[model samples]
Target: MPASPSPLSSPPPSPITPNLGLVCITVGPEVRFRTITRTRYLSFPEEERAGVLHALYGDNIGRLAGAAAYCVAQGIRLYRMSAALFPMLDLEGDPTGQRVLESLSAELRAAGDAFTAAGIRVLVHPDQFIVLNSENPDVVRRAVYALSFYGLIMDMLGFSRSPWNTILLHGGKGGRAGELAAIIPTLPDAVRSRLCLENDERAFGPTELLPVCREVGVPLIFDAHHHVVREKLSSQDDPSVRHFVLAARATWTPPQWQVVHLSSGIDGPQDRRHTDLITAFPAAYHDVPWIEVEAKGKELALSDLKQRLKPTP
Candidate 1:
């Protein structure tokens, strides 16, 4: 019989099995190399407003490109774009504002191309100012406007109505799920297409938000950490956690992997805050393909989690 091959001659045992699939680690728009500007129309001199706005757009586009490059280097496939991308967008009626929008649109197209080339998934979570179920009509109007603006940005990025490039939002105000369901039909086609609902830590948990999400025909974004903080629900052992995970998974149609958010609670009597690193993995969420790490440490936390999954020699 031929002598057994020496350990050095043996092929490096197939590299550790890759994780279920590509995980989306958030590299949000915060590259330290370039500075981003938040220019408002009234903040600059009347004669210089247009120039100032144009410069801001240039800075943002540069920063976005840098962020994308960073993601590619770090193996991060999912990123959340900044909500303050174009701060004074409401002034688009004026010639200067219109020019800024037009230029930004072109710049975004190029950035989108780079992201698509690298297979990056882009997401946008508008700020809390967006409350679809607010009792005030003005508030609702502003919320709708914000969604439309974000939708426009998505379109410019060449991201069609797909879960891969999603717009996440919390199910607004407790007890208003039905109202939210009702208003879904009234939203513009652009806003409704890319919208995704997420259960909140305090108000709407799966029990309250699932019905609304189903009614509106949008996928749900399950945040495991939020569930644990608010309801003591554990994705590892809680039956309801598994049940809701499947429920949320079902809402996603083909070509869209279920996206879950993972984070660890800070140590405290009633800890709900996200810590820098995840202390435990959601065993039930192992099957989910795309998990967005929301810890304060961001990409560094993801690296730690990946190490945990590596097999011991």
Candidate 2:
């Protein structure tokens, strides 16, 4: 035999070389974030909400601890907590409601502190109900009051709304954007710096949402699934999706990270449902720092993204 090739002729080149260009990493699944949104988890069976949280997050403290632990273990830089918990007042009539709010605020503060200490940022998203209800002046007053107390714990405030609501644009063409700008000023400077707007499943994609965000001086959370839904609903092609992403990029400023949502879609007779499936978008245009997978099988979806995103040195 000609000289046998050395078993390790060329030891694998160093595998840890860093890519000079932007890099995208999948943080984890989005449904995991929804653990706090008991109501949205399922519209019916009101009683199951607590059970679900218990099962997923263990008790409230357990949930916060679990979230903190997850971020630390996975090297995830950011995590989102559902706004459902923020609207603790919804349970106020009950005798325990006040205690619950205090506990929740404490938990949030602890969790936020833990995350920050671990070098991760926690972003809390507001529910659609809050914004729609905020349109009422009375509700606005109450929301502002409640936020004044609990807002201290969060690093970023996310607002996700339905398309119809955006169409109305509460104040003008830039509905929630305008509302956020007006209301954010009322928030303590600490909270205002953390505000962010998310794109919903409705017709309004980043293209429509970015203008409003720019006017208000906040960043945008581009939910990939929402863009997919908009593309399918509007019958647009790949170019449309690319356009939307580019538009969002234009609005982003430095030091204010970009958070994007990723998931799959199930095509039904009339519409497509956002499923937890990961796909590739050329890395040439966008380098997302955080991606939340909005799928039913959250962990499984996360694993899939990991495999797909493995470093290729």
lDDT, candidates in the order shown = 0.70, 0.47
lDDT of 2 by residue, 30-127 (tens): 12332344355456364654444444432544455566676577655555554444333344333233444444555545655675577655555554
TM-score of each: 0.84, 0.63
TM-score of 1: 0.84
lDDT of 1: 0.70
**Winning model by TM-score:** 1
Best by lDDT: 1
Clashes of each: 0, 4
lDDT per residue as tens, model 1, 1-313: 1122112112123333322222232435446322234443566688887777778777777777777887788777777777777666644345575567687787878888888899878888888768999888888887887688788878887887776788888987777788889887788777788788898788789888888878878889887667766786533346666777888988888524678886666672136776666666655665666777766666666676666655557
User: Which 10-residue window of candidate 2 scores lowest in summed lDDT?
Assistant: 162-171
Q: State in Å the error of residue 155, model 1.
A: 0.8
Write out the backbone clash pairs for model 1.
none
